[model samples]
Target: MLQIKHFSLRFSLYGKGLEQRDLEVISSLDVDIKAGELVSIIGSSGSGKSLLAHAVLGILPANAHLSGELYYQGQALTKKALEKLRGREIALIPQSVTYLDPTMKVGKQVMGVRHDAADVEAVFRRYKLPASVMDKYPFELSGGMARRILVSAAVIAGAKLIIADEPTPGLSETLAKEALAHLRELADMGCGVMLITHDITLALEVSDRISIFYSGLTLETALRRDFEDGGRSLRHPYTRALWKALPQNDFSPLPGFQPYAGTVTEQCAFFPRCTMATEECLHPIPMRDLRDGKVRCIHAA
Candidate 1:
C-alpha cells in the first residue's frame, strides 16, 4: 500500500541573469492505494502525473525539492528507505520502452537481480509471450511485447506496489487493453497499483478510484461509479466537464484551457474556467471528505 499526503514538488530554476526562482509543478496532491486496489490518476499532459511517479521512485533531478510526505505500508519513504525499496519492494513500469536496455537481452533485464529464468518464463507465458522472446533484444521486440516485458519485470521483482506511468500510449487499442488488464490482474493478486494516465475513459474501466488532476493539483478523487449517469455524482466542476467531454457522453467541450504549470495561484486552480466560480473561490481551497470521496471545491455538495 502507498500513501501520499499534501505532496508538492518544485524545481529551482535560474531565470534571466542570476535570479533563481521556484517552479512549482505539483501541489497538495493526496492519494492512497491499498492492497488489491488500483487507483488511476487522470490528467492532461504536463499535469505532473509522471513527475509524481518519479518523485516516489526517488529519481527526480537534483534541483528538485519536495514537501510533505510519501509513505509505503505505514513507513515514511525517506531517501534511505527509497534506496532500499526501489526496484525491490516497489517497482516502476516506466512510460517509455526506452527504459529497457538496448544492449541487454530481454530475459536478463526482466530477470533482474533474482535472475530467475523459470519465474521470468512463467510470467512471459502468462502474457502469451513466446519463449524465444527471452533471447531477443529490446529493438527486436514489438511495442506490445516490450510493454508486457516491463510488467514482467515488476512481477519478477515481486513488488508490493507498482507504479505504471503512461503505460498504454503508442500501442493499439487491443494492446492497450491488454496492458491495463495485466495491471488489473496484479491488483487482484494483492498488489497496490497506481496507474498514471491521461485517458480517463480507458482508466475508468479498470480503476477502483479516479483522481481528477489539473494544473498540478488534484481537484477530486472519486469512485469510478460516481462518474456514471453523466457524472451527476461527481463533485468537482472540472471532473463533471471531463466526463461530459468524453465522446460516449455529452461530448461537450469545456470553454478554457488548463493553466500552465508554475502559473497556479493560491486560489482554486479551476476558478478561471469554472462556470460556478464565485468571489469566494478566489481563496485557497483544501481537499475535504465528501460522500465517501474527496473534493477540493468548497462549493461542492
Candidate 2:
C-alpha cells in the first residue's frame, strides 16, 4: 500500500524565488497504489513518468526540489526515510540492466543486496537462468539474460513494493512477455507493483488498474475492464485519443508531439495539442470526480 498526496517535485531553472517560470518538472500529482495491485503509468518520454518513479524511490538527483507526502503502509516517508527503505522494502528495476556491476558475477551481485545465496539461486533458477551463467559478469550476459538478472535482483531483495521502469524496453516481443509474466507473478505474491511504461497493450495485459499521465500531470485512472470495453467511460481528451490510436486489425497513425518538461504551462498543459480545445481550455483545469475515478480536464465533466 503506497499513496502520494498532492505530490509536487520541481527542478529550478534559474535564480531563487518561487515563480511560475522557475518550475521545470512535475506539478501536483496524486497517486494511490494498493497491495497486490499492479498499476501501470503510461505516458510519452518526457511526461515525468520516470521522474515519478525516481521520486517514489527517493533516487532523484540533488538539484531537484521534492515536496510531497509519500506514505508506505501508512508510514510517512522522507528522502532520508526512503534511503533506508530502498533495497529492503522498495526495489527499483531501472530502465537499463546494463547498470549492474560488470566486474562481479551475477550471483555475487544479487546476493550482495539481501545476502541470501539460496534465495538468489532459487530466483535465478525460477527465471530459467542456467547454472553456468551465475559465474559470469553483467557484460558477459546477453540482453535478455541481463534483463532476467535485473529481475532476479529485484525479487531477491524481498522488497514489499517494486517499481519497474520499462522492464522490457530492449527485449524482443516474446522475451518482453516473459519478463512481464515474471512481474505478474510478483504481484500475485502480494507485492505492490508499479509498472512504468508507454506500451498500453502490455500495461493492459498485466495491470489491475491503469493511470494515464500527460504533460507531467495525471489525466485519467480507471479499472482494467473500463479500458478494454472500448474505454467509453473515459473522460479526458488525451485518453480518448490514446484509445483511438490502438491498433484494431488496422494500423492508423496517432498524430501528436510528445510533451516536454518546460513546455506545459500552469493552465491546461495539453491545450496546445488537444483537438477538443476551446476557450475554457486556456483556464486552469481542475480535477473533476467522475464517480469511477478522477480526471483533470475542463471537458471531463
Candidate of highest TM-score: 1
Off by over 4 Å in 2: 13-23, 249-251
Off by over 4 Å in 1: none
Per-model CA lDDT versus the true structure: 0.93, 0.81
Output candidate 2 Cα RMSD: 2.8
Ten residues in sequence with the least summed lDDT for candidate 1:
111-120
Note the clash tally of each candidate. Answer: 0, 0
Per-residue alpha-carbon lDDT of model 2 for 1-301, expressed as tens digits? 8998767778756555654345657766777888898998888777888999899888787778877789999988886888899988899888997679777888888887447767777888998998777789888888888888888888888888999998877789998998888888889999999999999888889999888887667878877877766767777877877877888622445576756656776668778778788888887686666756778887776
Model 1, span 1-301: residue lDDT tens = 7999999999999999999999999987999999999999999998888999999999999999999989999999999999999999899999999999999999999988776888889989998999899999999999999999999999889899999999999999999999999999999999999999999878999999999889888899999999876689999999999999999998999998998768988789999999999999999899999997999998999
Q: Tell me the lDDT of candidate 1.
A: 0.93
TM-score of 1: 0.98
